[model samples]
Target: MRITVGKWFQGGSPWVWLNAGAVAISLVMVVGLLALIAVRGLGHFWPSAIVAADYRVPGQESRQVLGQLADSETVSGERLRGAGLPLDPSLDVVERSLIKVGNRDVTGSDFAWVVEPWLQDAHYPENVMAVERREWGNFYGYLKAVREADKTVATGDQAWEVFQQRIARALAIHDQIYQIEKHDIGSINARLERLRLKERGLELKGNATPAVLAGIQAERAALDAEYKVLEQQLGKLYVAFNRDSAVAETADGQEVILSMGKVVRAYQPNAMGLVDKLAFYGDKLWEFVSDDPREANTEGGIFPAIFGTVMMVILMSIIVTPFGVIAAVYLREYAGQGFMTRSIRIAVNNLAGVPSIVYGVFGLGFFVYFLGGQMDQLFFPAALPAPTFGTPGLMWAAITLALLTLPVVIVATEEGLSRIPRSVREGSLALGATKAETLWRVVLPMASPAMMTGLILAVARAAGEVAPLMLVGVVKLAPSLPLDGNYPFLHLDQKFMHLGFHIYDVGFQSPNVEAARPLVYATALLLVIVIAVLNLSAVAIRNSLREKYKTLEV
Candidate 1:
């Protein structure tokens, strides 16, 4: 029998095809976006050959320009002329390249766009060095001499090798200084502060005795002594760190001296072979994930943000899962399915659609001010005026996200619970199991996969949220991680960084727009990868649960 087009319409085949096409289009768009992000982000670390050229433009003197070619585009000649550039009226289009000039201290700008037609004698110089600095961005120049205490130690043919050796030594010293300052001395300072608070508490309680006071003073003295010793060690390390410097001639023939202590890494991209470039690229990629931000968060790694994001998501899962499951169980198994129950379900569904910033406002007002303030007054009176839990921190951020995602978990779990056969429950109750036992041992195991599905959904939403976190706990830069080697291993009261906010800060709030653009893409890609890993892990567990209960459902 021939199938007519009108019959196909009645049979819903067209709708099926339409839905499949829509799904295919969505998947393609998501994949294409990921590919674009990866290309723009990962390509930033690869070493590009530095180009030396003389930029000649109409009505302006030609000057030496040195930097990496960042991007290129074709624009109308009229646009170029409107920007005060004297372009030929006969030409319809003009080609230009955006160059990363790097010497921000000298030029006051990190990037510039120049017309390609006026670029003369463009070439790569093998001796040209790109110095990644701890501040003020990168410096591009030619190696001149390596200095030790204002005296030239290596010059001419051997300066590069000597400079590299000294830089490596300086970096080692810097690491030691970091450890001493941020960890050892930091621990002592924290302990000393605790002792001070303890002493004050004793005094406030009218319990200040000579014996207790003596003990506190003794501990404080010991910590102070330790701090003094670390301070002396840091002093010596600083002296050694500042011992070496390098002189280089810029593209414009200006000689500049860069301190070895301020340099992060220096390399000649033009002189590198393919293997060398690959190794360099790998190192930079690792640094982006492991190092701390420098130069107003435009340079270096974002490990803190990554750590905070994962920690917050894990905490939110821990908080939301049990509460959501309990609520779901009560609604599905115990509650009378009447008007009140339906009303609550409707309210929950509506909550899922509430603006996220409203949650942030609620978290700040109730959680931070009311609940946390009560906690501080009840438990930590010695730290009065200086709020502990009374301010925004990690704990509040986690709780706020959990509250935001509770509706998702409840809806998903209820659906899972609804799917179980009534016969299954009757059989359990008939077999000498109580109602609670059947619900706990039989029903819950079969529905475990659904609980995990809800958790996965919650994590997917919580990880990328920036607004609520910004109000509750997230900061531009957290000097210390919420989880650290302190006495309380996990300080729930401490503020922390987040990858989503990092992307926002770097992308929109940065002063150096051109330098921050690539970092924004890289951080965004990392956030996506983090979310994917969390979802995949939950999915794996859900699949395992589903397999384990496959026969039980039957």
Candidate 2:
């Protein structure tokens, strides 16, 4: 012990040091990737601007600028009104003015204006205010303002105002329609019920019921005729309300038609006032999450994607856990050693190695075609040719992923089950517990930590998966959420958007590759962060369970 240091140095090995260094480097790479994703993905939630062409008269040009408008202040004899503040006339009064282009006025007029700061490398006519600087509440506030403006223009001020009034009217109308529809539905149901009852009655009588059957047939015909009329009326109302129309008035009080683009520009955010920049970003970030989907990119928010991801993961977990656990239990507790068990083990291990794209093919063929086709035929006869189950949807995607990750969960759970001391099972049985009771109450609980570890691994894999989901359910754009207002509203057969596929589409399929590259990175970062968060949560749960079961240590 006194002289061991010199002998150890003489027998030094470089391989050990090299191995340690490699491990350190690997850890650093992983941590760096995580940091990059968190920073970049979170950054996109903040506000940024895109410069586009401004085309109009040589003296008057129009450009699109995004940001919120500054608060309005009215000057009254050297005092500011509307903002509850007194004006300092001596302080530089920055008066913002927009030229009346094509008979458009600043007040009560929706005209597109580009902020001064956003103008770069673009020529502006001598008379045109190509760039102007104004204050907006935040990026999201700016977006909201634009949306309101778009709606106002598309329907015409009078019409749009009328439409707003009509939205309430529409709700009332909807209720009325629902009542009428309900009545019709009830009538149809009653007729069908009567037909069924008469059929049953005729069977009981057994003597003959041509008259009763004829009466039933007449009732059916009347119901069908009434339903057709109601359907036609409903269709007409839907069309009348759904048509897009906008009104714009010229400076001379002449009105003209406007497109969604025109109205959006006219109603763009007014940036006239400045406030705290940090608060602006913070507010904008919140808005990004809360806003509605826009026409092209669905500008209001990413809420749908967030919702979809959470829903898919939860569903996939629900599907995978029981199946994986049960498989593990059977292999560990019930299955006897033999060629069959060994073959089953090999198949499970091989399943983990198969490329996920293959699973997509399997999902599309089996789940989307075979199983779904059978379901559609058996239950949804009225929805014929629509292929409810045959379409790519969240349910199928979840099931596909559950299958894809099943092997991992099974292997991990089996390992965990194997590690539990046999004595625990024996003890439970000795205390008068049945095999099922011992497994469920004692063995399963003891193995839960390991099971969770497997689940965490599965979640991380599934959360980042894009290949299978693409074939099964992921869409480039979805107009409405999977869960919405309709009969059996949570339509699992409908295609849905996913962050992983969004990254792929933006990176590869986008028209503006350069513009979308940053977005791709941002999305990738988001996916990584989501997976990390899930894994971290699982880790926390595992730690808690481990602590709870610490006394059961082998």
The C-alpha stretches of model 1 lying farther than 4 A from their native spots are: 1-3
TM-score of each: 0.98, 0.62
lDDT by residue (201-270, candidate 2, tens digit) is 5665583478867877888788788878888887875554344433433222344433222121121212
Task: Kindly report which residue stretches of model 2 are placed more than 4 angstroms away from their true locations once superposed.
Answer: 1-20, 34-276, 298-300, 485-489
Question: How does model 1 score by TM-score?
Answer: 0.98
* Candidate achieving the largest TM-score: 1
- Candidate of highest lDDT: 1
Query: Candidate 1 on 227-341: residue-level lDDT in tens?
Result: 8889999999999999999999999999998999999999999999999999999999999999889888999999999999999999999999999999999999999999999
Query: What lDDT is obtained when candidate 1 is compared to the true structure?
Result: 0.94
